[model samples]
Target: MKAYIVSLAAGVAVGLLYNVIDVKSPAPPIVALIGLLGMVAGEHAIPFARMVLAHVTS
Candidate 1:
């Protein structure tokens, strides 16, 4: 639960930082949401890739 909350806060901070950097854009919120999802997916993918690599090597 705590990790989830921290992830959420980090995502929000990333989103806000992006918006601040590109204040003229109108899609900051969507970009932020996509970024959050990407982060989660990427995290899961790393271990999956590592497992695959080990299996292939062994």
Candidate 2:
């Protein structure tokens, strides 16, 4: 929860900075969010795969 709050605050700060600089964000918001979701899923996937492999071998 704390991490989520901190990330939200940081995102707000970056948004304000982008408005001040008058430049478009590198990636559209939806695309960037999807990328973040992919990263999180990928991180969990490795551990899940390892667990399945271990179970199969045993």
Per-residue lDDT for 4-30 in model 2, tens only? 999999989998999999989775689
TM-scores of all predicted structures: 0.40, 0.48
Clashing pairs for model 1 are none
Clashing pairs in 2: none
Please estimate how well model 1 matches the true structure, expressed as its whole-model Cα lDDT: 0.85
- Residue-level error in angstroms, candidate 2, position 53: 29
Top candidate when judged by TM-score against the true structure: 2
Q: What lDDT does candidate 1 reach at residue 28?
A: 53
lDDT of 2: 0.92
Task: Kindly report which residue stretches of model 2 are placed more than 4 angstroms away from their true locations once superposed.
Answer: 29-58
Model 1 is weakest, by summed lDDT over 10 consecutive residues, at 22-31
| Clash counts for the predictions, in order | 0, 0
How far is 36's C-alpha from truth in model 2 (Å)?
7.6
User: What are the lDDT figures for the candidates, one per model?
Assistant: 0.85, 0.92
